[model samples]
Structures are given as C-alpha cells and as structure tokens.
Target chain A: MIKQERAVRTREALIRAAAESFDQDGFTVASLTRISSRAGVSSGALHFHFASKAALADAVEEAAVVVLRALTHDAGRPGSSRLQHLVDATHRLAEALRDDVVLRAGFELSGEAARVPRTDLRVSWRDRVERQARRCEENGELREDVTVGRVVSAVVAATVGFEVLGVRNRAWLAPGTIAEFWRLLLPTLASDAVVARIRPEGTLRSAG
Target chain B: MIKQERAVRTREALIRAAAESFDQDGFTVASLTRISSRAGVSSGALHFHFASKAALADAVEEAAVVVLRALTHDAGRPGSSRLQHLVDATHRLAEALRDDVVLRAGFELSGEAARVPRTDLRVSWRDRVERQARRCEENGELREDVTVGRVVSAVVAATVGFEVLGVRNRAWLAPGTIAEFWRLLLPTLASDAVVARIRPEGTLRSAG
Candidate 1:
C-alpha cells in the first residue's frame, strides 16, 4: 500500500512539473530534464512513470480531462435548461482555464501546431457542446431562425478562441469575457422569458 | 530595369515557397533547402533575398499583411455602417484565409508557439475589430444592454477562434460560418431596424 501510494504521489508531482514547463515554454521548448528535476525525481524514475515527452503530455491532458469533467459537471444536472447548461459550462471552463495550470497546459498542448493530439480535449469539449445545442434545438429554446449547427459553430469557435487568446493573455479567460459572449448570444437564441432566467455570469448552481 | 524585375520575381517566388512550406510543416519543421528548391532558386540566391528562416517568415507575413489590407480595405468605405465594416472584414478575412496561402501561413506563424511573432496579424485584426466595435457603441446602433468592451470580446474571440479552427478545416473559414456569427450577434447588439439592414453575408459592395 505504501509503495502504491508513493507511486501515485510521484506521478502527481511529475504531472504538475510538466504542466508548469509546458505552460511556460510550450511543447517544443519544454525540457524533460527540468521537469524531472522539479518533480524531485531522477531521469530514470521520470521515464519509468512516462516513457517520453509525448507520454508526459498525454498524462497532463488526462489530468486536465478530469478537471474538465468536474468543470462541466453541471451539464448533467437532472433538470436544468439545456441552454443554461451550456452557459454555465463556458463560465466554468473559463474559470478553470484561468485558475488551473494543468487544464491550461492541457489546452495549450491540445492546440499546439506540432503534434497529432493524443488527448483530444478540444474535440471532446466540442462534441459535448454539439450534443447540448442539439437538445436546445429539439426544445423551444432556440430562435426561429437558429439551427443547431450554427449554434455549435459560434459557441465552439468563441470558446476555443477565448482559450487560444488566453494562452497569451489571461484576460481572455475572465468570467466577464465569457459573460459577454453569453450576453450577446443568449438573447439571440432564447425567448425573452428564458433569456431573463439564463444568467450570463452563470448561475450559483454551476459557478466553479 | 530587367535585372530589378528578375530580382522582384525571385523574391516573390521565395516568399510563396516559404509560405507553402510553413503552412504544411509548421515553422519548426519547415526546411530552408526544400523551400529554395521549390522556388526554383539555388541556396545562394535564396540567401541573397532573405538572411535566414526567420527573415523569410517575416517576408511571408508582410506579403500576407498586404493581402490583409486588401481583405479589409472596405472598412474605409464612406457612409458605411461601422457594424457593416466589421461584418465585411470578417467575411473577406474568411475568404482570404480560404484562398490565400501566404495569409493562411501568416496566421499560422502569428499564433505559432515557436517564436516571438514579428507580424502581429492577429493583434492588428483585433485592433481593427475593436475600433469598429467602439464605433458601433457610439452611434446608437448597439442595444442599450450591450457595451463596447463586450462587443469587442465576443467579436474578437469568435473571429480569432474561426481563424484558428479554420487552419485545420476550411469549413470554418466558409462565408456562411462568419455569417452565422453576425446573424446571432446582430440582434443582441442592434435594434430591429439596424439588425434588418445589416447584411450577415456582408454587403455586396464589399464582397470579395
């Protein structure tokens, strides 16, 4: 049990160290030597945990996926409006991108120009969004002219854009930045009554 | 005159070859030798025009900027609505990204993690959008609830997001993609009269 616990702790430290390096310098410049040293492990030990840099990035992305799941957990709330589900998810995602290094690094790596992304965080996030937009279409939530595909395109692009800009400037990931997106987008999709009830700041029920 | 014309043509060929290489393999992986070969120029001739890879990339970006100027030149159209100016810019930008390799590669390099970007394509584009959004706020075209900063945030994020996503998928750069963005966002910021007049597909006068 102690050996397994130590193993887990070592893995956690390595992931954190890798996140910091990847976040600061990007994948091409990220140094595995620095990461292992920061994690208080030998190169051999680091390699034992992760076979290569890509493997390490995959682990960071995995840790970030866990964070993403928790960030968007409100989407599964038993009875919330599908529109609200999306609004809250964007807000929570912004919060995560702003506050969490692993998630931030995961996002950076996912969008990096160098690799075939192994983690698929952006694709999964986009898929979840498309699914919810479809639900909104089935109900009476969308505007008369709006289609699920259009909503998906706008929401995905804006959120992903925020994520991209946030790589250089954290302001892009601020709650207000996403709130502005919702404020403009919500009214275009929801009925006046529904729009009134949908909180652009995200409801207390889902604010991370 | 003949000698000077040959030099200009050789420089143009090198820049186009560099852009094609950078767009396909990214900045880090692009080979100078391959670029010169593709340009039908010897290594010495390529070096005479551009000092190094970074210099070549800068040339590509500058050429792309010239394309960008023509792409958004309609912003100067007299008596045009500022909202329409922004809309036309996005549509023309999408078309340019779809059709122009130098512009596309410039965008890729501007967002690239490998170096400090010299061109500032995204920054200049965002600045233009901010300028037009502020104009919208001042002209009573915006709804009472929307603010200039919010408009800038939503518009910049969505448009930049489209540019980034469009790098991989040309569909994101489709005219309809940007039109949908304006379609959803127009009603949120503008009154019914203004919204009805705003062309989501952009104006015929400015269509590229």
Candidate 2:
C-alpha cells in the first residue's frame, strides 16, 4: 500500500510538471528531460513510469480525464436538481478548463494524439466520454431528441474548440469568452425552461 | 529585376515545401533539412529564404491567409449579391479546408503560433470574416437584429469548431458533414425566404 501510494504521488508530480512545461513551451519544445527534471526524478524513473514522451502525454491526458469525470460526478451528487447540476457542472468544467493548465494541455495533447494514431490517448478519451454520455442519458438530463453519441461528440468538440480558440485568441477574447460560450451553449441544449432563465436580464425569454 | 524574380520564386517554393512537409509529418517531426531538399535547394538557400522553422511556418500560414482572403475577395467581386457572396465564400472556404492539406496544416500552425503572445493570426482572420459579414448585412441577407460583429464571430467560431472537430473525430462524421453543417447553419443566419427553402430534402440542399 505504501509503495502504491508513493507511485501515485510520483505520477501526479510528473503530470503537473508536464502540464506546466507544455503550456509554456508547446508540445514540440517541451522535452521529457524538462518534465523529469521538474518532477525531481531521474530520467530512468520517468522511463519506468512511462515508456516514452508519448506515453507520458497519454498518462497526463488520462489523469485530466479522471479529474474532469470526478468533477461531473461531484456535481451530480445526491442533493442537486438535474438542471442545476448540469448548469453547475458546465460552469465548473469551463472554469477548470480556463484555470487548470493540465486540462488545457490535455486538449493540445489530444490533438497531437489524433494526428498520431500510435498514441492511445484518443481512443481511451473517446471511450470515457462515451461512457459519460451514457451516464448523462441515464440520469434523464439529456433531451430525448439528442443521441448520446452526438451529444458526447458535440460536447467534447465544443469544449475543446472554445478552450483552444480562447487560448489562441486571448487578446481579442482576453477575459470570460470561454465562460460566455458555455453560458450561451449550455442553455441551448438544456430544457426550454432552463434556457429561458439563463439570459443576461435574468428573466426567462422565449426559446431560440 | 532578375535577382528579385528569382528571390520571389525561391521564397514561394520554400513555403510550399515546408507546408507539405509539416502536413505529412506534423511540425515536430518535419525537418528543415528535408524541406530544403524537397524544395530542390541547399540548406544555405533555405536559410537565406527563412532563417528558422518558425519563420518558415509563419510564411506558410501567411500564404494560407492570403488564399482565404483571395477566396473572400472573389466571392465579393462585382455583380455578386453581398449575402450570396458571403455564403458562397464560406462554402468555398469550407471545401478548401477539407480538401487542402496545406490549408488545414496552416490552421494548426496558426493555432500553435497564436498561443504565444504577439501572433495576431486570430485577429486578422476574424477581421476578414467580419468584413464579409458587414457586406452581407448591407446586402440585406441577414436580419437587422443581429450585429455584424456577433454574426461574424459566431460564423467563424462555428466553422473553426466544425472543422477541428471533424478532423479529430473524422470517423463519426461522414465525408459530407462539412457541407451538412453549412447547409444547416447558413439558413439560420439568412433571411426568411432563404431560410424557408433550406430543408434537408429541398432542391437547394448542399452538394457534398
């Protein structure tokens, strides 16, 4: 148990270090050497934990997925209303995407993984998102008109798109653009009643 | 005049070669040496044209920007209706993004470049789109209710969102999805007469 705990700690440290390096220097320039050095581990130790830079990136991405899943799960915990839960989760995810470098870097990593089929991160991430969509459907949060698969795909695509665009165009959309995108988009997918109440004037407007 | 002509040709060749290399192997895996070789030039010649990989990437992205601008310009040429021109330009851009590896790769390069401060590709792209939106508004193709800036932003965002998503999740979305997205989206922004005839089964349906 102690050894396992230590291993988990080391893994977390590696992910955090890698996220910082990737955000600062980009995917190509962020070397494994820098990640390991920041994590205070030997190069061999990194290799033992992750076979290569691609492997390390996969681990980091999976860890971020786990974090995001945990957040959605927490939002849906027993006491919250379904609509409130979704709204809250949307806010949380958007905020986390903005504030957490790991979540942001995971997006860039996923893009790279998509281009390189050898990286397993894309497949695993896809499966996890699919499972989450199923869970959302089960909870009756999703609209009957929506397919779980389509919803999952749209959610992933929109989230990634908004985050990436925000990061890339930070000057024009310097503050609160990600937040605004979710604010606009979430209601469109939500039940009409929820959609009505989420306006700038705080009054329920007619449906779009 | 002779030296200037040769210099222009070398510059164009270098940009084209670099774009092809980056598209085939991604930015990280593509080598400048290989690009120079593929351009049928020496390392010294490539250096004289572009001092570094980043410099080469910038040229490639600029070329793509020029292509998109030209596309928009052609759509807005004399004798074309403004709204029709905007819609047509969007269709052309979508098709080019789907078919041209160089354009798509340029998108990726611009995305990475934008993350770092001082890269203004995002702003320039948005400005170009906004100009088209203004033309549409003047032509009475769009609703007076929607602001040109807002419409342009949404249109640009959705286009980028759809393409990036399509590329990442290429399997779920069929080859025709890009056309489908625009078909669905264009009418949403168009006047009621255009909106009325845009159903899936209508003769005005988008071509794949």
Candidate 3:
C-alpha cells in the first residue's frame, strides 16, 4: 500500500513538472527529459508513467479537467439560481486559470497544433457554458430577448480572452476585471428583477 | 534604379517567406535557411535584408501595423459616427487577421516570449482602440454612463479573443460574427438616438 501511494505521488509530481515546462516553454519546444529532470525523476521513471510526451500531455489535460469539473459541479449545486451559478463558476475558473499551471497548460496545449489532446478544453468549456446558460433560460433568469447562443459567445469569448491576455498582464485575471465584465453584461442579459437578484461578485462566500 | 527595384523585390519576398515560416512552424523552430529557400533567395541575400530572425519578425510586425493603421484611419474619417468607425475598423481588422498571414504572424510573434519585439502589436492595438473610443465619447456617440475605459476594455478584450479563437476556427473572424458582437454591444453603449442611427454592419462604404 505504501509503495502504491508513493508511485501515485511520483506520477502527480511528474505531471506537475510537465505542466510547468509546457506552460513556460510551449508544447512544441518542451522536452520530456527536461520535464523528468524538473520533477527530479529519472527518464526511465517518466517512461514508466507515460509512454510519450503526448501521453504526458494527455495526463496533464485530464488533471485539469478534474479540477474544472469540480468547480462546475460545486457552482451547479441545487437550490441556487443557475445564472448565479454560472457567475460564480466563471469567477472560480478565472481564479484557477490564474493560480494553477496545470489548468493553464491544459488550455495552452489544447490550442497548440503540434499535438492532439484527448479532450479539447475549449470545446468542453463552451459546452459547459452553453449548458449553464440553458439552465438559466429555463429558470427564467434571462431577459426575454437574450438568446442562449449569444450569451455563450459573449461569455466564452471574454473568458478565453482573459486567459490569453493574462499570459502577458495578470490584471486580466483579477476578480475585479471579471466582476466588471459581468456587471456590464448582466444588465443586458437578464431582466431587471433577475439582474437585481444576481451579484456580479457572486453570492457564494468561499474564495475557491 | 533597376538594381534598387530588384533589391526591394528580394527584400519583400524574404519578409513574406519569413512570415509564412513563422506562421507555420512558430518562431523557435523556423529556420532562416528554410525561409530563404522558400523565398527563392540565397542565404546571403536574406542576410542582407535581415540581420537575424528577430529582425525579420520586426519587419512583419511593421507590415501588420501599416495594415491596421490604415484600417483605423479609414474608420475614423470625418463625417462618420466615431462609434460606427470603431465597429467598421474592428471588422476590417478581423478580416485582415483571417486573410493576411504576415499580419497574423505579426500578432503571434508579438505574443511569443522568446524574443522582445521592437514594437508590441497588442499595445499598439489597445492604444488605437482607446484613442478611437475617446473620439466616440467626444462626438457624443456614447451613452452618458458608459466610460471610455469600459468601452476600451470591452473592445480590446473581445477583439483579442476573436483573434485567438480565429486561429483555430475561421468562423470567429467572419463579418457576421463581429457584426453580431457589435449588434449586442451597441444598444447598451449608445444612447437610443445614436443606437437608432447606427447599423451594426457599419455605415462605411469603403472596402478597406
């Protein structure tokens, strides 16, 4: 049992190291040998865990999916307004993109043409945003005229833009930046009654 | 004069070749020799035109700037609503990003961290957008409550987002897509009087 736990820990460490290299150097230029060295593991050990660089990237992407899925799940918990849930989820996601190399690398790698990821992070994000927006529409939180497609486009584009811009300037990832975006958009998207009920900063107290 | 013209042609070919290579292979992996061969020029000729890969990237960025500045200029022409000019310019810029490899490579190269650029394309773009938004405010095209900074943020972030997304999906760069964005945003940004007068497809007749 102890040996198994150690192996799992080593695998996690290697994935983190690979993510760091991919995020800093980009997928095309980053090397497996360097990733192993950064993880303080031998090349043979890295090979044992991941047969190739693509496989290692897939593992990193999977780890990111796990983190993002949890954020989405928590934001969608029952009894909360779906629009509020989406607002909270987007804020949490911007925070993750800011603080977590694995999530950031996952997004960057998915965009790189040199490799095909097991899952496309952007597609998944669009799907999630669409799904949440549909729920908001069903809940009557949306204005009578706002379409789901337009909301998805605006949310997805702006959030993805923040990710790219934050690559150079971190201010793009600040909570206030996203809050301001929501404040500007919410009035346009929701009925006045719903808009008043929703907080751009989000109602959930937890920072996560 | 004949010799000078030949030299100019050779230099232009080399710049186009370098932009193509950088766009396809990215800056780190693209080779000067390969770029010269693609241009049908000798290695010595390429060296005469550009001292190094970074120099070539600068030339491409300068070319992109020329195109963008022209678009901005046409949009800001007097007798047109400044807001309409901003909309038309952004659409034209997106079209250039889709159709012009040199311009696209210029943006990608500017984002690369391996080398510092002579000019940052993103900074230039943001400055131009801010300047245009200020013009719109002065012309009384904007609603009283909408600050220039907010307009700048919305315009910069969404346009940058479309560029990044369009790298994978050309649909993001389509005229209809940007028109939709402006359609949604204009109603909130302009007073009812201005909104009624503006067309999301823009009022400008120029193709530039």
Query: Which one wins on lDDT?
Result: 1
Q: List TM-scores for all candidates, in order.
A: 0.91, 0.75, 0.93
Off by over 4 Å in 3: A74-79, A205-208, B74-79, B204-208
Write down the lDDT that model 1 would get. Answer: 0.84
Q: DockQ (C-alpha) of model 1?
A: 0.64
Candidate 2 lDDT score at position B182 = 42
lDDT of 1 by residue, B1-208 (tens): 9999999999999999999998888887788999999999999999999999999999998998898877766545556687887788888888888888999898888777767788878777788787778887776788887788888888888988898878767788888788888888888889998888889989855432
Best of the two (1, 2) by DockQ: 1
Docking class of 1: medium
Interface RMSD of each: 1.6, 4.2, 1.7
Error of 2 at A168 (Å): 2.8
lDDT of 3 by residue, A1-208 (tens): 9999989998999999999998888877789989999999999999999998889899999999888887777435566689989998888888899999999888877667556668778777888999999999988888887889888887887888788778778888888777777877888888888888888887656432
Q: Would you list the clashing residue pairs of candidate 3?
A: none
Candidate 2 Cα outliers beyond 4 Å, as residue runs:
A1-4, A42-48, A71-90, A113-157, A170-208, B1-10, B74-84, B113-121, B138-141, B166-175, B182-191, B197-208
Question: lDDT, candidate 1, residue A43?
Answer: 93
For candidate 1, list the clashing residue pairs, or say none: none
Which consecutive 10 residues in model 1 chain A have the weakest lDDT in total? A71-80
- Give the lDDT of residue B93 in candidate 2: 61
Summarize candidate 2's per-residue lDDT along B123-180 as a digit string, tens digits: 5556777887787777677755556755565556655655565555544334344344
If ranked by lDDT, best first, what sequence of candidates would result? 1, 3, 2
